[model samples]
Target: MLSAGNPYVLPSVLVAAGAYLAATLLTDASLLVRIGLLAVLAGVVPIVLNRLLGGGSADEWRDDPIEDPGDGGADADESREA
Candidate 1:
């Protein structure tokens, strides 16, 4: 429906780019520390931004659980039986 995968591509890239730039500022920090900053920022910031900004309709973005109909397929043969 919603183009299959990663509807937040642009926001993700922007967040990642910003993370890279911010991580680069820590020139004296160890590689692992810089990597950790990038990992957390790149992974978490985009989703937070999206939720805070209300980037799209709540229905489109929210992950609500679907309710199953009570009938299921049990009624499929009811008319034929009558």
Candidate 2:
């Protein structure tokens, strides 16, 4: 069975397969129509689906980004001295 939460990989594969089919089967279509279809199929649609299905902000997937206080900047010392 296929897994569910993969927002990028599956859709991308489907788009690639669909592009191959379109290229082979859609020769009678206009160049402008083919370009537009390929743009949506390979670029735009998968991106939109990924964003819609990719739960949570990117920050939530990582450790907190706070810098260590001991990694002192000149500003830290300057403020203390002042």
**Which candidate tops lDDT?**
2
Task: List, residue by residue over 1-82, the lDDT tens digit for candidate 2.
Answer: 1224435546666876687577759677776776777666666666566677773444553576577666578778899998
Root mean square deviation (Cα) for candidate 1: 7.6
How much does candidate 2 score in TM-score? 0.43
- TM-score of structure candidate 1: 0.43
Query: Which regions in candidate 2 have their CA more than 4 angstroms from the true location?
Result: 1-10, 13-17, 23-27, 55-82
Predicted candidate 1 versus true structure: per-residue lDDT over 1-82, tens digit per residue:
1121334546666776776777678567777887777666656655665567655544664576575557854676686688
Clashes of 1: 0
